[model samples]
Target: MATSIFFFVLLFTTVLSRTTPDEASRTKTLDITSSIQKILNPFSVKTFNSFKQEENTVSSSSLLSFQLHSRVAVRGTSHKDYNSLTLARLQRDSTRVKSLQTKVDLVVQGIGKSDLKPMESEFQAEKIEGPIISGTSQGSGEYFSRIGVGHPPSQVYMVLDTGSDVNWIQCAPCADCYQQADPIFEPAASSSYSPLNCNTQQCKSLDVSECRNNTCLYEVSYGDGSYTVGDFVTESITFGGSSSVEKVAIGCGHNNEGLFVGAAGLLGLGGGKLSFPSQINATSFSYCLVDRDSDSTSTLEFNGKTSPDAVTAPLVRNSKLDTFYYLDLTGISVAGNAISVSPLAFKVSDNGDGGVIVDSGTAVTRLQTDVYNTLRDEFVKGTRHLTSTNGVALFDTCYNLKSMKSVEVPTVSFRFSNGKELPLPAKNYLIPVDSSGTFCFAFAPTSSSLSIIGNVQQQGTRVSFDLANSLIGFSPNKC
Candidate 1:
């Protein structure tokens, strides 16, 4: 009885020591005592429905806008419940990261030797088609946007990708197509649809193409073996009722397959000339993603809104892989203390072999192996007062908070070469991975030379890509 009492007293004293007034004030902390139900809400498949909310409140003449939906925030054909779907999503996220790394490797090796062109001689054996962005597809993109296609525009959901170039859709006469929520687009029904001739400049722009009865036929093969093949055509692509781009290049896919069963096709928001934003001649674009657990939808704007006081960072261009938006991430800090990783870990090599990119399609932030470990170790040390639990999925550090109503966690921030600091919200990093009140660190390590700052880290921040100025800006808490 005496021993038990003494042990209890010691434990109480230790806990109190960490929470004293002075110590608490010095530490940058986060309160995570909310209901487990709120934390697990995003994982529940049923939480999101099939309601098509009107994204644009004003005419597209002012700004081209579309509501962006996170993968789990949109109702789809999948029937998996919360736990199963959550696991599936994480597995798919891993697949997406691997494919991204593979694509980067291929791009660096192919273009590093020369200027901007991939080594066609090497890829001929693999039969890789499309541009440098044509590495692979796992249907692992994270966001969706509903858009109007063709003359009398038919509304369809398109997966948004900041890493791709060509805009494509699964058209009628699909020789093969996965299940989708919307009807397949029919070229015959649109008066504005025009197939490009094999001799056109647009046809010649594709990395690989074929001539079929004088028509331009294109094929894009992904790393996972998924592919889309059809005619390259021009159509009237509408944003809202008031604005439309005429003769926009689009891939009318007659045969398409892979994990993209929920959406009609993909909309490329990349930096290449063939990307949707580039095709439309937009100077810039911006988006503010809501929290994964929030029910609200955010808008993707073209030449539209942005915070006046957004901190800006110069957008670096990798001549080898110009399709991606590269950022010079200098360092990272936990609770205002910088990690011990070398700055070279985040640098883009002169040969374009290694670089950090801000990608909309990637879900979790990935860092160099050494950088990630240092950050994770520092975070763990800062939260030593919290109860530790087994890791979840790709996240190695986790906390069990089943008993606590709330707990304080260390704050994390990212620093850029321009001396701009992007301080993240607590919910963005310490994300709930399950209903058991288990929260995991959302960052992960990658052996690949490429590093990506994913959407999770960008949540609640207004991220703007200023192509004209060659800059990227971050406006915090603007979602």
Candidate 2:
């Protein structure tokens, strides 16, 4: 009990900074579907009018905000025909998407009141490495160079995604019809770039149509509604630094539609493509991120598995499954109390995509109906007697946020795929809403997925996505 209580206080620390209006909005919008719109409105000029047009755009906030409110939230995977403009990964995909959102909301609500400082500090390296890479395409505006350069080199801004398997970019002479990002990946001029023919081992792995010329074909959708379709290519990509990787199989998007601004391509970081490292003459994928350009040198860790000090936090390493980091959940806790959640079987559905996805791109954690309700109940029972928000129509959860107890926040711990349990800041998990009079923790009126572990929950935590080992690892740090 004492240990639990200690964690309770530790988790509640972020709330100390929540006195700002930003937090007030997050407290309300956490469970609501338009969280990113509400959270980033102050910073961005874009209206974020609809779900489909929202995902592909770069946010004034981090990429995290852009990923949270996707078209998927509005529709399910069944609507795949809708395109990013309509068929996006439905704010709820595979019961798992819902769980992820719920998890993020709960943690935000719980940790909004924590005592920790905002973890926006930075450290960078000259060259980026690993699966992280900058997106590139024909029309994608100006590419922000970490070390500069790539300008007019047919620079393509690529989408860095964890939810996909194919690493693809926009290409020229595509009959499929696509808006360019920054000039297409020119096959003729790119001395190092080459397409994979249908007969190769790589093309056969897609498991769908026959690999005609060693080219594996694929298409991917996002929650906010953006999609790309094209053939795979075996090419060489260079990072800003000295490292370069060759023969990396990537998708050359031949067809794309809807809200594809600057037409940047995608950086596939899921288990499958990211797991295989580049051979002798090439370096694998990597990135150098910094909130402020004036910040210190941001470091780069190859494969982030052995080296724990990759980011601000020590990464917890877990192996990859195909192309995803499957973080296992040993148990789910509410109100600082642990719950008996079955492995893979979400209380809401027999099919568990139940484990948490340590996505650095997602803004919140999506949770299952049962898990969300249990945690909400704990918040209602423990906090200022209620949680509420001003905008009731767009989002849910009840008012009484003022009276909500500031102390004893519930700590939500996740057991990683490697048998390690990691506890996140409680406020980073819950959301508040207001009704006619009573205030209660209410689930998003539209939520239907099991869970998604977003970037917010990953703050200060280093996540190691090891495709080779088939696991992901994370470690907490003082953000």
Candidate 3:
């Protein structure tokens, strides 16, 4: 009797040691079965099908706001089925991540070189157009905003990209152009349109340019062999009837080809000197990405009001690549238990080799291989009671939750250098990958040294970029 009682006590102690009160409090009940259905057809429903022209752009005091929508939601591309569309989106996501990696590699290589003329000398060696550091495009940009392009303000959908610096649009008399939802912008009809001479300061600011018939010509090439070449011009870009920024330097692409379909062009929101935010002298910007399964629209605001409830982290600058919003991620926790990971995994080198970037374009979050392994292991251990299954695509950690109506999940949070933690929503991390109720961890491993905090993990969170103050803030459940 004594021996049996001792064994029972020992078993209880082992179980108690596995879960402390602090850790137990971090767990939340998740409706896994129901949540799985929402993500299976992520692109099936859109927040809004048609744009309300009058309400497209709204300015309140100093803030210039625009209605943001997912690319697929804006009626650009037609997919045969939801599964196929979801698969295609995932494929594009992978390609975009690879292309972003290449851009980072090139930026690092160009460091210490002539910042003003870095690409001029190397352009001849590589047959690609523009500087490699100008950034790549692959029709992978996720969010888009509608804005007026001409005097009467022809409404057009422009992809919102923080990774790119040059704003461009598909113009008329095109040698080649990808199919888009809106009719190509007719430069001849817009009285506010004017070509920039090769000698203009704006033309000279381009990473790579050529003088043709005294008009400045610009070209941007992508890692996937996509290219857009056209005349560089300045036009009056209208936000609303009362608000308009004139002579905004923009690319009028006559020859363009790529995976870019649905949207008219891209609005560059990078930290570079040529990006739209910089050109307008905007002090800050903020965006709240709505959940893919949600039918609600979100706002993308410039010079916007600050979020009082947001937890901010200092934005670390990578001198080699100032376009990306790099941050120091000190650690991560699963159910209040810190995952064992080397700080060096998230360190940004002087030359910008390895670091973490919060990108609006990428769909899935990627971490350094070692760090991701530890995170995956920790999460799996916490969720052992649930049945494990084979992962889908980029996700190696997955589970079959078809039989369960609801399950308690370990809450995940990211600890930044400022001691502020960004807690993730349950649906954001454990995403549905298929219709069979197979859910997988949304985060993936990147072989490259750079790690990306993608949109999947940022859902329902208001991410603010205060460029003037050099800070990025995360306010949860704002979308």
Candidate 4:
């Protein structure tokens, strides 16, 4: 007990000790004591059909909370455990998809579909309550290829991603040979290795990043006004273990910008993009997500950190975002009470590149105009605590800083395109702040290039970015 407490204290303190103003203050004031107490509470936590009465006010700010995230991968140490080979394949497949997509795009144009592009899937993900989970990799075809099973011959770090859809990194191609933070893909030796060239179908017909010399190269822009350009390559890809060999797209080039953080490139999963090279099954690419703050570490199988009582709903699929799933968020609640707010209506769009992405990059849950007002008004009701600085409203609706009360999971039920409704965990509603911050919304505030759904609200759901179906599916389950 003492040891566990010590570790918790240590981690808690470390989280609070963040140096940056934006991060430091929030962690320090997260009210961890109360949150921990709530976690330890013996009573059964319940789910709410709606939110607190206060969530109704529309956020005065033009900006909605957006979600931006990256995965933390532990690189395999030995050459046998390296993720280098898989890197090659990821790059190769990307090129193939682009060529195929170019042809498809032309077909759509021929059919008079003005903005005709591949279809997509949309879904909602609920936030969980455990430490980040790390599931086992099932090999070439499984979701956890970053953490291969059996014994991997080569290993690499998880592909660092921006919201962009392309994932690639410099491999042996760089003689400087520094151990950049992101893993490198060695295409020279891979059996399935291939590099793009200028004559490729995509390069010849589309305006996308050109595929020259067997390399697909392009620049990606970020909400923060950042971008990266690189070449695409194909190499041997693996998952679970050696037996799970698959093809994947990989980027390789000089990524000097800090945004990529030594990352060669990103694994694209957006609807706007034309490919899913990262997926092993020539059909779909699955990008399994383990919550940043989850507790389970089963590799590919992270039994999320959701409340046990949160009810399960039908898994619905949608064509709105190609292959992504959509959530039926009918209501939100606080402290076990439903807020009197109307549900939101949604219209999906291709964010930026061609990938299935949930917008966790924004600061507040910026719903469509009408939905935004409804949810905001309901979230701020019965405010026992309130504060404002620099003209932002901060509410005390969060759990006790030391009590860990089971804030009734704010149910964000979604009515899928397939007509199924799913009620996700409640923790997705009670966001954590380092300090007494304002009620952070989950949508992007600025009418930026792409609409985003921030991570602050993805607290207890299983979000799957499947490229095979060109869908981003959200499973409303307890974390």
Model 4: per-residue Cα lDDT over 310-385, one tens digit each: 3332222333333223333344333333445432234322331221124322223333444444555554443335
Cα lDDT of all candidates, in order?
A: 0.75, 0.40, 0.78, 0.34
Identify the leading candidate in terms of lDDT.
3
> Which 10-residue span in candidate 4 carries the lowest summed lDDT?
135-144
Q: Kindly provide the TM-score of model 3 when superposed on the true structure, using C-alpha atoms.
A: 0.87
Evaluated against the true structure, the overall lDDT of model 1 is 0.75
TM-score winner between 1 and 2, please give it. 1
**In model 1, how large is the Cα lDDT of residue 174?**
74
Report the C-alpha lDDT of model 1 over 171-211, residue by residue, as the tens digit. 98877777776789999999999999989987877765677
For model 2, the superposed segments whose C-alpha errors exceed 4 Å read 1-153, 176-181, 207-227, 261-263, 273-301, 305-321, 340-356, 360-362, 385-408, 415-420, 430-450, 466-471, 477-479
lDDT-best of 1 and 3: 3
TM-score of each: 0.86, 0.56, 0.87, 0.52
Worst 10 residues of 2 by lDDT: 140-149
- At residue 444, what lDDT does model 1 achieve? 95
lDDT of 2 by residue, 1-479 (tens): 99999888876875665545443322222233332223322222233223323213222322211122221222212321222211122222322243234333433344321322221112111121222111211111111221101222344444344544565666766645455424556666766666667677666554232243444555443333344556667776554333445677766666644344343465545545332332221122232322110112222234333235432212222221333344555455554356655565332222222344555344445566666666556555555533444533322455543332343434555544344456554434443221123232323322443355655455444455444444455545512
**C-alpha positional error of residue 159 in candidate 1 after TM-score superposition, expressed in Å:** 0.4
RMSD of each: 8.0, 14.9, 5.9, 18.6
